[model samples]
Target: MNEGYRKDIIRYLSVLNNLGGCHIDTINGFLQKPSYIGASPPVSLFPSSDGKSIGDALYQLSIVLERMTDNEFDDTTFYHSKQLKSPLGPEEVRRLNEISLSAKVTQDYMNTIGRVFQSYQLFELLSSLEEQHITLISKALTSIFPMDQSITNDISTSKQKNYQGIIEKIKQLFSRTKIELFLHLREEIEESQKNPHKSSISQATILDTLDIKSSEYYLASALRQLLSTDENSLTTLVNELRKIQPLQITQLSLLPFKDFYQILDLQANFIQMANTYQFFKEDSNSQFNISTASEIKMPSTPEIKIVDQPPDKAIYKRNVKPAPSVSFQGDSKDLDGNYYVSVALLRCNDFSEEPTFLNGASKPTKITNGKIVTFKKLKVMVTSHQQGETLFCFRFDLRRYSSDPETNPNDFEIVSSVHSSPISILSHSTQLKSTAIADLPKVTEVFPLSGPSTGGTRICLLGSNFADTPAIRLKFGNVEIQPEFFSGGTLVCNAPEHPPGTVQIKVSNCQNQWSVTSATFTFEDTNTINPSSNISSDALSNILPESVFGLDFSKTFDTNFIIKGLETASSTLPSSNGAHRNYSKQY
Candidate 1:
């Protein structure tokens, strides 16, 4: 009986795996196979047939299965069923009988099957059973699993918080321009809804009449409210309206009231309407009125003062100062071909402060031809100061009027000249005298000379004194040759046209007395000799170097012997005349 109980439990588990979710077809396919076997218990070594004892154990199994299915068990139901004198109680017997009589369990047996299904992960089993059945099995498993109410509430709160955050961000973006308009439009809409005839029909009403969505409808409605009465505020509102129109007007037919003139007319109408509804007014003529609620004063206009001055006759006066000549070193071009003059004024000993005209003094500096002369005003006060015997240094950039006199009405001409003030040589006695010698021009060590034997050898004469110096004269032994000076301390020259021997290449600057000499260079004439002719006989005494004629010349010492042998061999050979005679005779 114990073995049978285990077998029954195994069969119940197997059946649950098949019957769960929408896995009916897959379960049927697996069960129809020959190899497929239903769950059976291991053979029980000890068997009991005592109905009361067996029924007690069966009753327990029944209660366990019921608990697995419903996820809860009733102790009262179990107790009442256990009193019956049967092999199994009413519920337990019925479940066992169903398993025994059928090859497969039907949907009616689902309650018992659910008990076993709940014991194991039915979803995992169903996943392997069929692909299509996964979602159904997942739903079933979710339904069976116990949920935490607190966790669910927390998730819901988190979602609500995220939604609120998104809403706040959207409101912030809209509030920049749209919100104010929306509020005004909403007020108008509310008023329109309350009293249709009393409220002025806005262009926003046309947008609403087109049955636009809330997002699209609000922008136009809001903009119309912003420009309702104030025409001066229309400029700012028009710019804001441009941004909204493109975003909101996906369909062109929605906003029928979009002409500029129509908008202006609407604004004018709103102004007129607002002016007509003014409830309070100031009574300037009356001292007091009892019926008047309150009298408000309008803001007065600000007064502007204007002064008139008689035009003076044109008088030419010169307040000119002599300027020294200056040489500008760089590219300078006139913007309009007008003569520009720049002068560098020297600072003098008496010049305490930089030159500046006194307050209200007009010193019109004019340039006639290419020279600048200042025009004297009636009450001009000019003062000169010297600092340690030098006046303040000033650079005056003046433009000439004669060059393009028609264009310049100021009657000032820029002197096409620049000036430098006298160099203020301080008194020698007061100036700090340095005992140390002034920085002498640096003389660099000459680089080692290098070049070909064909006379012109370029040698880099490296040193500081070489800079700005015209020619660098290099001494090759006693011969002095001036090298072409190039930028980077390089000197190119013929190497004194020396013989094919080692010569000392020396370098000296044209400006300096000191000379730099290089170590002797053993010059070899590359075109002079055949290199093979120079090979010593001692080096090739035994094994002869191969001759161009492929002969062992070292071994063949006797030339006369070779000549005699060639002569004897020629005697044995047919002569050219003899061969010609034989050919003639044969013919």
Candidate 2:
């Protein structure tokens, strides 16, 4: 029963919530934290109240949807006002009015008979639907009423009679819809209890009830349509509806076009508005010419950020995805196998939040390519200690669409979710891709450019932006060499054996970026090595070869020296001409 009830509640909330706040946030908030509405024992119509009842969950859900603003809550509701207090602005008041209706609705559930129909999500859905219908009704009234009769007190007996009759008809239509919903809901409850797995309501069914296709809304529309066709009825209805003053004469007129355009800009559709504007060169219905310049020069194009990929090149469309870990076996001494990566999904308008790094994004935020909201991507590298193996799941948002997609944004979040628990950063990489390199790593020079062909010659390498890389590897020809020391400006590695010719010194970074040194290392051939003819026995006994001596890791070396290590024996030999010269050389 609990499973069935929860599923049904979610189904209801999916239709009701502005941004899935009710479905995702409300219940979780109630269960985990103290109730914002101050529920102590968790009020319920049932005897057993564990505080996790479906009805209680629904109630909390209603509060959440009723509270969401356009920015923090969803992409659609720009200004949220659930916490509105004294000295409110007009916009704040307007936003609060939607939530205030909760009191009016909750009052009906004070008794047992009323509590039977007291599903929080169901009421939330109905209230939101009612608000939507009211807006539609207001628009309909505004378009039909005559400007001249808008302020008139002249109400004919026949017009008054028609008005009263239509009002009653509207009441009956709405009243009947409630009865039908009540009966259908009861049947649904029974079915859901029988099979909890199939307890969900189809999306199409929920949309019909909340949308213009709902019985009462459809009936009201039919009534309006019938009257519009009948000229006399329309004339009387328009005159009567005008007295109610949904739209004024001035509001409909272009007499104050500039002011009206300013007001029009406040709406979401203002950017794409294809409204019929009646413009005249002079004020009194005079024909005007289309404003055109005699000669034209194309203005300089603005710096657009979008770059089209060439036909042969693959497109790089990044999305919020999981971060993966890989074995970072590199020549860089500092690099370890552990790495931290996350995809940031939230777009914050205020970046001054110091405790958390939220970027200040203002109006005209990233809303391109049919994107409904703005999101700031935050990528960071961390150690395993900073980010443990915390398990995380994902959350999704659903958008609403009208019959005419051209006129309305398809990504409208009439239905969306605001989870209390955050979706975790992508911890692992499931999708494999070629390493991305925005910049390449460089190896400027390798000190002591020549070494013995036997290898194990230490060389100091120099460059910049080395530590910035996640991993760095040094290569001597085909063999990947291990680095003894590495930093932003320098790296140390032992040269591997190669042919007597010069071998290129190459460096590769974590992102698969590669760079090579202009200065290459030459392997000194054994054929070039010969004992110095004037070398003494003392020098041979005391001195070691350059190959046998190790380098100072802290310092860099660049000087070149002779290849021969042994000294000549002291046995007597011939003099200067073709001499095996025996010289007294000190060690």
Candidate 3:
């Protein structure tokens, strides 16, 4: 027997041995094989053996098989097969044949049971039927069974009749039950349509008829329908159900506007209204106005003069007030009759001069009484002079009345209003000096130009520009290393440990001045070898030869040498050893 098949037989045997109240022949029939008197414990438990031992083993095997078949092992062919070639009586043989036939029938029936359940469509349909109808169908079908057999003769004929009867009964029952279910469903649907509030009842009925669990899709669909009808009560009920079954809520397809657009529109309108009200209130408080003005000019000759001149007291004033005279003047008189007059004049000097210049000037050449007189044409001539010579000047004088002439000047007190020039003091001063060269230091060299892998190695940087305390930065390749500045020239930096190779170090100071240096360093595996490990050439040479030239006895040894003394060694040993000893003694 194949080893694999033998193992399968062993598992079957174990199952049979553990089963209770089963028969030997029935178990053999389940195995689809005759019981052999000696099968070497099914070849899995033991090897093949002769008839005498086989007979005893078969008897024990039968006991195990008996428990497997539930004691239904009266099938004679399975038991009689243990004798192998022995001829059986006619009556015994006939009985064995009948048992074989019945065993085949039982196996066929068991096989059909599994197939029946595998028909998924049938199971689904049966599941959809009303519970009462299902129970009635089962009872009616079961009734024609084993019950009819007990009361009838000729077992084969009775079984056939019962089977046919139950099948017919199930068909008739399903037909009647379906008709009733359809009528009920129709009425429920009709009522639901009349009153959408009762739609839940109709929905439940349809789901029950289809035998579908109240899944998320189903519940959500029902909830959505209720919401569509504007049934607040139904909607609330559905929402409450969703809380209990969160999955149903997740499955629901929310109405697009209900949760999104409508809420957005409402917020937008509220914001717009608030803005509109703000604009309206602002406009009410502040009114707008528009006005226009016309431009007019008076000639320098004064179209009219309103001065009171006393007869016989002529007021003589200075002629030619100054070059570039200011023609326009404004004065405002307070209730006290004190005049506050301000004058603006354009300057005509190559450089500006102080107002004090006006205090002491040569008296006017032409004087009328105590007032100065100017030719009207002369005033016009000054206004049209060359660009640098003609200018407009402004002046302001405050005139106040005093009770005593000695206490305050009755003459106008001239006040000078000069515009100060806008210039920065820092720009005007030329004494400020530039940075001295003594402040800058020079750089020399960087040591251990490389960094540590774990980073943190203090390296000495040699150079100048090292101030009292200068910040240093180390650069390896394009990557820069941040260093701790310990002193002016000395920097404590952790060398960035990099891959084993030559690296460049750039040392810099607080002034951003840097110097580049190169260093070659090897990265050693600290775990496997000491960082300071060194090997001489001689030591290496000696170790290499010993390891490479070593011989292995295991590879050279033969089976004959392993099992016995060497035959070849015996023939050559004596003469060769004698000759070698004599030759050595002579030397």
Q: Score each candidate by Cα lDDT.
A: 0.31, 0.33, 0.30
Q: Residue 555 CA error for candidate 3 (Å)? A: 51
TM-score for candidate 3: 0.16
- Residue ranges of candidate 1 with Cα displaced over 4 Å: 1-393, 398-412, 415-587
- Residue ranges of candidate 2 with Cα displaced over 4 Å: 1-325, 328-438, 468-470, 531-587
* lDDT at position 545, candidate 1: 40
lDDT of 3: 0.30
Q: Is candidate 1 or candidate 3 better by lDDT?
A: 1
RMSD, one per candidate, in order: 47.9, 30.0, 51.5
Writing each residue's lDDT as its tens digit, candidate 1 over 376-447 gives 222112323223332233334455445444565466543322222223222231231341111122334332
Which candidate number maximizes TM-score?
Answer: 2
Off by over 4 Å in 3: 1-452, 468-471, 510-513, 516-587
All candidates: TM-score: 0.17, 0.22, 0.16
lDDT of 1 at 304: 11
Q: Per-residue alpha-carbon lDDT of model 3 for 267-347, expressed as tens digits?
A: 243234334322223352233111000001111211111111111111112222112111112221221333222322223
At residue 506, give the lDDT of candidate 2. Answer: 76
